[model samples]
Target: MKISAFGHAWVLRWRWMLAVLAIAALPAGLSAWQWQRGEDKAATLARIARWASEGAVGLDGLGARTDAAQIDGMVLDFEARWIAPMVWLVDNRVVDRRPGYDVVIAVEDIGAARVAGSRNAPARAALVNLGWIAA
Candidate 1:
């Protein structure tokens, strides 16, 4: 009887420890899933940020052959066309302390009408939303 009680107690204690370990594992599992999903997006965004800070490749021939998604994500050398935009269009608005504009820098694309938006932007020459700016 004494041996049985000790064995039973050991089982109970192990059960609780296992439950705690499972609980701790849940968050780690979720984090791993999220990281996998965002791997491409994160890498692409990092490259874009680098391009923004360093410089831009020419808007003309850069994205001609490549698809929109690739052009938007890949960072390239600085180009003169990227400097002077056609116009600063206000793409969105928010009600806050003051009005702010989500702007896209419209630039002429070689085969397309325009190129704007983040580095991960589509290749189509359309209005590309870059980011927010104070009005």
Candidate 2:
């Protein structure tokens, strides 16, 4: 086969471009893999609460001294409990009375019906993720 210099140059350039693209893909691929692993290990707040309740560890059992190995990527269950006195509700923005100013907060049961606790309405509080809000 007779190969032209122009064709060879084009092929080399394209190969270099592909190599650059592959290099750029590494960090993104790594980030996605880490995110997926986190998701796999993640547990919902309600699930954690339910687990604690069933484990006979009541909410109190989960204190600061508690092992981090217990709940690593646990997400808060928003639908588990919806209390009254909508402090501030606009559109879909429902802000509960603050326990502290942060992305996460723990609230006490102010006479709201418990969920997934027991047969009867069990009073319970929960750690909630208010999520990030735009200042």
Candidate 3:
């Protein structure tokens, strides 16, 4: 019995075909994942913009919630005293074609006691991003 050309090719080259298919699929899957990530980021940015336009709310208004899932995309406002000496800059930020770092500083919220809903809780320092500056 003789096998057809298509059947013969499949029998002899099945491994190669599988390997090629797997190689092709990897990049396609990765591209899809990256596209989804981009979409998520865009949606998050839009939400932040909309919330910001509605004006800022104090930290105390949001309570003492520290769960990232609850506040990951929130735009918050609070009165804080800058701890200038603890400033740090995050590298690789770009603005208007200029490379720079994002300025971050630790600040103690004056209303932190209210935020924790207690007068005895010690005020905590939080890092705040103050935008990008030229490197």
Candidate 4:
């Protein structure tokens, strides 16, 4: 069978286009999967946050140092505990921070929760006391 030059060129171009489309679609497909799994992700994150807060309070009560080093350590511990699991849930990092050092916990549908300042302190304190937030 003889193929025309135009036919051959069209086939090659079509193949290239398909490849490009597939490559572009990859990230979108992954995003859809993440969204479908969002509830589970959110639940896992909330659980981790709760645990970290509780832990922090416990360590603080036990006279864990409140110095900068200690605070940084606690923040790291909290991130490791909670943020790691939901790393894929958001396009960016799991936690976003404000200029004033507030923590933003991202949820799929409801947007973000701010955990800082006087607003979340009571809940944070309770979680800390329960030994969930880490030292």
- Which candidate number maximizes TM-score? 3
What is the TM-score of each predicted model, taking all chains together? 0.38, 0.29, 0.64, 0.24
lDDT of 3 by residue, 1-135 (tens): 334685463344777778999999999999999999999889888878877787777666567778765566577777788876898989998889999999988998878777679878787677788888899
Q: Give the Cα error of residue 118 in candidate 2, in Å.
A: 32
Model 4 worst lDDT window (10 residues):
126-135
lDDT of each: 0.61, 0.54, 0.80, 0.42
Alpha-carbon shift of residue 94 in model 2 (angstroms): 43
Q: State how far residue 55 of model 2 sits from its true place (Å).
A: 3.3
Q: Is candidate 3 or candidate 4 better by lDDT?
A: 3
Clashes of each: 11, 1, 0, 18
Weakest ten-residue segment in model 1 by summed lDDT: 74-83
Question: Which residues of candidate 1, in runs, are more than 4 Å off?
Answer: 1-8, 13-21, 33-42, 45-55, 64-69, 73-101, 105-124
RMSD of each: 9.4, 11.1, 4.8, 16.4
lDDT of 3 at 2: 31
| Model 2 lDDT tens row, 2-87 | 33685563334667778999999999999999998778556455567666566544354456634555654443233343443423
